[model samples]
Target: MGIDGVVFGCLTPNNWLDEEALDRLIEAAEGLQITFHMAFDQIPTTQQFEAIDWLSEHGIHRILTHGGPRNTAINENLEQLRKLVNYANQRLTILPGGGVTVDNAEELAKQINVNEVHGTKIISLPEENND
Candidate 1:
């Protein structure tokens, strides 16, 4: 597939994963950068940290989260997102997404100090390439 990375669109509610299966998937992907996408917000609040711990331990590169349920503004979940950013400091990266816009990326990054942010505002591709 010569793919650069993979993002799991949704994870189990508890972030439950089969490590052996994951290892196999990683092997199949040939070590493409792995990201647990926005579905991370579906995990229970109490379980988020634990899941992060396990994910970081498993060598996941990033977790794209809005800090709460999907479609919610990251602005509204700053506290939780900040906590996750701090917790993931050196182990794994937390890529904030959902409702993040170019106008607000600065404010969000200023507060969280994370170098990477993910959302529609970051890039805008033409509706149809005229090639």
Candidate 2:
């Protein structure tokens, strides 16, 4: 498939991520990259850290996270989120997503110390479309 990496999606504590699945995922990604995505509301910070650590132990380096609701502006609690991101970045690539927009994307990037912040509104419209 010429795949660069394998990503495990919709990971949660309630789901039975058996050894077979983990083994297969690892075998398939033996010489490639591996990442996992977790919805922000699905797990708590402690569990998130544990998952990240587990992935690191298995040589996985990329970790993606949903940033929860848009109503919960990251800017409002930048300090807390920044601390969490900083901690997680030490072990994995913490990609924050969900409810992101151009208005707060740059600020989130800066606060989280990430060069790129994923958002639906990060792209700039053509100048001609401004009208």
Candidate 3:
């Protein structure tokens, strides 16, 4: 079964994924993109930086995070997000998500100086019908 890649979420938190599981995933996803989603924020900041280096070393393609705490506006964590983005410069991709919306994605991305942006709010999804 050949799939484009895998998104780590809707399952367990990123920290919940032990090294064995991550290695297995990395091995199984060779030649494909393996994204570590927002759960990155669940880990302590100090550990998160170490994890960033480790993830990059292990070939994790990208990571989605809110930078500080979950549900906090991206603006509040701009400094932290910028640091993460800069640290991940060529090692891996850091995608700022969570409170990001289309209205602010541009400014955030610009300030963070990242080419890629994440979060569902960027796209306008149609409302559901009540019928």
Candidate 4:
């Protein structure tokens, strides 16, 4: 439909990547950019790096993640996020999301040395209209 890119994700009941399902999605994408979404965070920490390697090897362009458990502040997840960025080694982009906000996004990006991030609040709104 002329879209430039698509976010794709699938996980098994055990929180591992569902390669079969993902393959279908990738095949359907037909060369559009693929960003594996926050489902990356649902995988167990012990397996996350391996998942990164797998996704990179399989042609995923990036991953959107919170860097740690759901609902935790992004600051607390910085260490793990940094590790993920390092392990990726430019093989794929690590786009942090979850608790990121305009107020903290710049500092967080510098702290992790990543060029991109994700969040609804990436652009701030006035307090009265904020939602």
Judged by TM-score, which candidate is best? Answer: 4
lDDT of 4 by residue, 1-131 (tens): 57999997999999999999998888898779999999999999999999999999888999999989887999999999999999999999999999889899999999999999898989976568666
lDDT of 2 by residue, 12-122 (tens): 367423445666687777988876654433555546556556667777766666544346665654554565577676676776666568677787787778765656777
Arranged by lDDT with the best first, the candidates are 4, 3, 1, 2
How many clashes does the backbone of model 4 have? 0
For candidate 1, the 10 contiguous residues with the lowest summed lDDT are: 9-18
Per-candidate Cα lDDT values, in order, are: 0.79, 0.63, 0.82, 0.94
Per-residue lDDT of candidate 1, residues 44-76 (tens digit):
888789878977887689999888877676788
> Which parts of model 3 have CA positions greater than 4 angstroms off?
9-17, 124-131
Instruction: Indicate whether candidate 2 or candidate 4 has the larger lDDT.
Output: 4
Clashing pairs in 4: none
Kindly list the per-residue Cα lDDT of model 3 for residues 78-117, writing each as its tens digit: 9999989888876899988888897899999999998888
Candidate 4 error regions (>4 Å): 125-131
Q: Could you tell me every candidate's TM-score relative to the true structure?
A: 0.81, 0.70, 0.83, 0.92
- lDDT over C-alpha atoms for residue 119 of model 3: 76
Worst 10 residues of 4 by lDDT: 122-131
TM-score of 3: 0.83
